[model samples]
Target: MSNSKLFILDDDRKTRDLLLAFLTYQGYDTTIVDNDVGFFDAPSPPPRTLITDLPTLLARMPNILKTGADNDLVVIAYDKAESARILPQDERWLFMPKPLNLDELESMVMRAQEYHALSSRNPDPPADEYPHFLCSTIIGKSRQMLHLFEMIEKVAESSATVLIQGESGTGKELAARAIHQLSGRSNRNFVPINCAAIPEDLLESELFGHVKGSFTGAYANRAGRFEIADKGTLFLDEIGDMKANLQVKLLRVLQTKEFEPVGSTRSQKVDVRIIAATNKNLEEQVANRDFREDLYYRLSVIPITMPPLRERREDIPLLISHFLGQFNRDKRRLVKGFSRESLEILCNYSWPGNVRELENLVERMVTIKESGFITPDDLPEKYLPTPSLAPSAPAGVSLPEPTGIEELPAAGICLNSAVDAFESRLIQLALARTGGNKKEAAALLNLKRTTLIEKLKKKNLQAS
Candidate 1:
């Protein structure tokens, strides 16, 4: 592989060194020079690309922007109080934030390389599509999520009935709202009713309007969600839980765009868009004769399925940052963010509750934890004490274990380098013992499965 030449200017040696090490590991010919007024004076081979913080870049803007006009440049700026007051508006420039989100960095590097090859356009995102209106308030740019956004955008342009499916807490309601907000009827009201939340007896009246004395308790004229949602969208949540008899009535509305109010013979005309969501498998419900097949087809003119959180792990960090900012404002707290170790614990967890669960956890953590970064220690009990890297001997089997490092040169050793080497070796041994079954290997090593996978990547090893 051909390595890209990179130049970095940052007075902070620790940050510079970390970037240097990471870029070097990624096969980049990287060099760091003193970040001062005369930054362009670095020797023989001049930099073709540059990476620097906002303060340093602003102090040297004229020359740097001049140089950037001819070469690719990346600006890492801080947000909030110490933020770059005004972001650069040049297409040639790609702006990102720091102290650093490694995923964002990696994506930036890959896209920059593609840009240099003239095969890709700048990958810098717009100021924002802003916050998503989707359920659980979707936040991500992972391939899976990007595709979902595309699907939502396309479906929103029309009046097609929608059926959203996913596991509980997967944001089905959010998706429904997103579709409505993006549609032509955005200015109109969006009515949402939970099929499962309402009593079966009241659901029919709740959906289709009721005139006076429709049933035993219908004392006043009432507009149902469908009528209330006329000229807009009606969200039917937990739609799979809707009874078969009600499903027939729903199908009639879908077919004629009209329905009669209870206790009234006159049919009322309606122009409402339908967006239905459910956590249960509607197809299974149909097979079990619990749901009507004809109604299912009518309601599902367009189907959208949301993948669970575990499938889109890349979004974890972005979600982390987003939630931190979100709760900070809503709860009026000043919790900074997560410590690296705490972030690792979060990313490794299999979020069975999906984005909703993650959001709730962040809110809880920020609320209870004191002002400052959320560290491994500050994390809840279940997340603390990352799994051990060393495996224990089986109950009946005994094996000789390494005692300690015996050899040391006259010069004192680097403890971190030594620990990394030891950890890498033990991980390999554990993997071999488990026949490359990562879950089993993680168990053998007493590590969380996600923790082990990350270690495997850092060690340049393949994981099962």
Candidate 2:
């Protein structure tokens, strides 16, 4: 019925039937073969794509891979966890985790088709030129997202510093992890530090390590982030908040690729790629003498700014569906995904807190909702199309106060003003609750500390 053929072999009958139906609907000429029922010896024609479980594939992994290459087939190997061991390193092979996501499977299928198309046009393109940028967590079909993926693919092999700028919760650290994962140093540790979360006084020791008795509470000779990230990537998140003195030292590291541990004169050399991120206006900070201009230049060798969630509205549905499937798996629940109306409302709402906020909201819904598809009625009041109370929140869970929402003047209030007023009040409350500790305040608000700091700077209330 279709131009492409796929073969699936699984011991579980349910899985086998599900794959058959799903792939068939996706326009594939699909067939199911049992591993114990002469599956390997079947006289069926070679399929262009093969999806198989770990044990069955493992039994004859080497032979299967060789046959696929000979027959010009691509293999999608998946299992709970063990399938990873037998996965081929060959170009024609792809890997999937247990409880495979349909969206990711579809993406892999598209890549397989692309491979066939490209191989016909050119017998061989470089192996790395293939679509290895198919991480399930990095879900998006928007142009900007595709562009970001392309950038990651291009720069992954290089050792240049990468600076990712974005509003907090837009997934800056996720991008950094993507870059590191696609790079040659993926096997090494990916060390990350929130520059804004740490105190300015102790930041030096955190970055450069310290000798025993280097300062107060320096109990032992320890390695710093730079040393730990050697042969890997060091993600300095919220780098804009780094102290001026540390900026100078960081610039020196970029220039010479070496640094001395605190209280020690001996210099230590390490090969580490730097990936810095910030939610602040680093350029403005430089102009204001609050940040070092030289360090800014050094870190921004290849700057990548993450697009806000609102800007990439096309990605919202995909992300929502992904988080839904994830939560369903986490809770072992059969909760259906969002209703069409709920999806529209979610798509229309401005995600000021970005992806993290949406993800948090989804987790809450999946945990709290008892039955029925996630309808618009299930969403919080602020997110609703009309102001209405949601179901009673769980015990001990404090919902945001709806104070002043009920009453309105005859002409009604500007929605923007109302929302901002409410947000400001919540932020101040959280700040006070945490005793002015921005890190704790951010955690209490389920926000990144840098985001909280930016809000403070915006309100000119840093002194408060």
Most TM-score-accurate candidate: 1
| Model 2 agreement with the true structure over 83-186: per-residue lDDT tens digits | 55665466577766667666557656655654454344434334444442345457677777777777676567667688899997988998999899999999
Q: What tens digits encode model 1's per-residue C-alpha lDDT throughout 1-464?
A: 22445777777798889889998886787888775445455443432456667464655554656774435444444342343455445543455554475544544554444345432233434424533324346677777787787678667866767889999988888888888888999999899999999998888888887999878888899998888999999999999988878888888998788998877898888999999999888879877999886677667656789998877888888988988898999888999899888887777666667898989999999899747988887767654433434433323332223455465545556656666666776787676554356876798789999999999887787542
Clashing pairs in 1: 134-174, 135-174, 135-175
Error of 2 at 272 (Å): 0.7
The local distance difference test score of each candidate is 0.72, 0.76
RMSD of each: 20.8, 21.8
Question: What clash count goes with each model?
Answer: 3, 0
What is the model-wide C-alpha lDDT for candidate 2?
0.76
TM-score of 1: 0.57
How much is the lDDT of residue 153 in candidate 1?
67
